[model samples]
Target: MAPNRREKGNTVSDSDPHFSGGGVAADGFDRFGTLPDCLLVSILSLLPIEDAVRTSVLSTRWRRLWTLAPLRLLDDSALRSEKFPNKKLLAFRAFHDEEQWRTQEGWRVRAIDGVLSAHAGPIRSCRLSRVYFHIPLLDGWIQTLSQKGVQDLAILIPMEKRFYLVHPSLIACQSLQSLELCYCRILKPTQPRPNLVNLRVLNLKRSLVTDAAINDLLSCCPALQSLALVHCAGLRRIHLRSPTLCIMMLDDYSWEVEELFVVDAPNLEHLMLGKNTTRRTHVKVLNAPKLELLGFLDMSIKMLQLGSTTCFEKSMVTLSTVVHSLKKLAIRVDFNDDLQADIVFDLLRCFPCLETLDVLIADMDDDDEPDVEYWKQQVSLDCLDHHLKSVTLKGFLGQRTDSGFVNFLIAKARVLKVMTLISVHAWKEGWVETVQQGLCLQNKASIDATVVFMKEKHEINQFQPWSSLF
Candidate 1:
């Protein structure tokens, strides 16, 4: 081979003889090498950073393509290997092999740092999951990203470590449109807060953030549309006052949230509230005119105040204005003998225009069967008469109360097309057949109505059950 050489900065062009077939030939052609740089860079961007960088060795044309591509850095240990251990084994490994743990941690840090340092363009997104790094290194990387005008950033530390307080520069990034922080802490800014004018989505999971800090952050993001806070610590009372917020989810499995208040959110559309237990929390939804989807799961709230005059006490209540805009509603509650049917009826009455309803029955050991008499006392609602179309009931036990509630829906919901009942407990001999026969015999208001019965083994075994409704 006579000195195969090219000038510095000379990239392989489509017309190059070597690329066209003089020297390079794959499957009798060099189609890949002839592709445009932008298209190649897009292909590289989808691969993991490590894999993307390795492509640099393929050819001179590919050497610098990855650096120009939008950077997507993900440090997920679970994706590191196919045989990754379970949580218990991971905990054991973290405690037993200190040296190996440190070595792996250092390798991940260097890998991420090496890529961020070499890349010269704006990063599209960066996600670091279950990775621990030195505070200075993390701060420097965040500062670099801020300066580079990163659009999306996610920093998820390992659950075993203490909450890592994010750097100030990260919060001040004007280019950020979406941000997610898990197992971290959002510190109170010292001086004037930076207005994240473009931020639309914000998710904080298992974080340690005070109510004041969160409220202040929301105030700064005037254009925020979606916000999710899951199992956050030090958040007893959350007052959301965003005017532009459209979707919000609050999942405090620890049951630490004592009070939740939403005010002046005119554009609010979807709201999800979840708690692990049936804890008594105060929730108020006010001034949300465009609200459509509402989910209140795993809690028997003490009071749910909707607007000014409408409120739900221990039983339930209705807000005509609030429910008029609601199209979908989901709720999970423990079965109370005296209040189960009343609660369901009150909820249905509140949302006169609701089309979809999902009910997840929390398993309680007590034998407090659902109150079947309350079904007869149910006042006619527009939802049951005209609007309600779909009903999904999980954890159905086929008890008298459960069967009666189903029977009432079959007879009352004039527009209901589907009723899904998944049994949480194991079926006794001929129980499923009997329940199906009883539901079918009931005079359904809608002639097109169909009943679906599914046996959820995991629900009965006390394991988490998956729902196909969502």
Candidate 2:
């Protein structure tokens, strides 16, 4: 049998407001009134657009509340579905008769037009996702938004059958602060945007903008603080004039790195240059005053003109001036063993004040590993910075060069605390023993630093492993 419970209109406790000792009134739910408009808007803004719009049907109080909150404009073409409605699609195709097709197309255009026009006010953020439109409609909407003053705009122009072009009026946004354009095809050359003075961050990732267009865009964004260009293929020589830009990330390796001139960037802190899939034919130099952090892979001989007298001479001249003031340095070597060692020495000598060094060796061929005693005596690690505290050698396979560098670090870096050796290939049987010999020779009395011999990236091996080496 079920225990006895309170029935409708019955209350047990008088102390609690919810429980009216003897009997409770049905009107108890009507105690709270509408919240402040600002608070309600904040709550609604956190909801998804579909759910936010659903608030309009909630009650009389919420009818127009959603419109008062922030609006996120979405394009219909950006939507993706797992399955298609075959029946509905067939029905739509059947309406290819002139009048019906015209009617359907007209309604579709009008719906989108209405959505965009409705939110033509002071918007906090606007996202135009994969939207395609003719010049007239695009211009009209952008001009309207510019007049209304939008703060953030994210335009992701996808490459598809439909023609998508950026309207010149969009760049004239007076109140725009943050703008992102991804995967956009440049249909025509655009006039630089001088009016977007308040723009803080500009990201053009995988954009079809030409080098000239990039320069023009950078010229307009004088107050931009952070700039990112990933696979913007046309960008060659970058000339940054923004005194406010402190952080930069350029990830296109195909473009010849022209001299980067950062003018009056007092606050510039970090600069990251990623690998170029295609070789950079020309030498690139960076000039910045306050740039303390730099992340760039050392260019290979093939990437450089190192083999030739002209390229080697050029590298020798530039490498000295590259990291003169840098406090931390990272060098990635991918070349012949003898050439790599020589370059490594030359590169290390550049960073006089380098405190931390991360060295990665890639594509070590089978023939590169020679007789241990013979190669060990030949390989040398000299002129390492005294201030170097941490050394990391990635893609380590216990080669003489690898052991030689470790041995050098163990001897030279007096203040060294940690040394890490990561093997991309499988762990050699005696790899640990060889590493231990280097560490033991460094006066076993000195602080025994942490040395890690790790074997990762084995699954990435394409060919059969060489069993003799292991």
1-470 in candidate 1: lDDT tens per residue? 22243434445553454462224453444666567788878887888777777787665666788888887655545334223333653775657677776666666677677778888767878877754555567789888888877888888877777688888887778899999998888766665476678899999988998878888889889889999887788887888899899998876463688878887899999887663322466778878888888876443557777775344445555445435899888777655555645556666767789998877776644666555566656656798898889888878877666676777888888999988887745356777787776664458889989888777765343212223112
Candidate 1: the clashing residue pairs are none
Model 2, poorest ten-residue lDDT window? 461-470
lDDT string for model 2 (277-388, tens) is: 2134343334465665554545453343211212242144444354445555555565345655655666666556666776656666667753334323432222242566
Query: Highest lDDT among the candidates is held by which one?
Result: 1
- Please list the residue runs of candidate 2 whose C-alpha ends up more than 4 Å from where it truly belongs after superposition: 1-32, 72-115, 130-148, 161-164, 186-193, 256-266, 277-283, 301-315, 318-325, 365-386, 426-448, 455-470
Most TM-score-accurate candidate: 1
Q: How many residue pairs clash (N, CA or C atoms closer than 3 angstroms) in each of the candidate models, in the order given? A: 0, 1
Which consecutive 10 residues in model 1 have the weakest lDDT in total?
A: 461-470
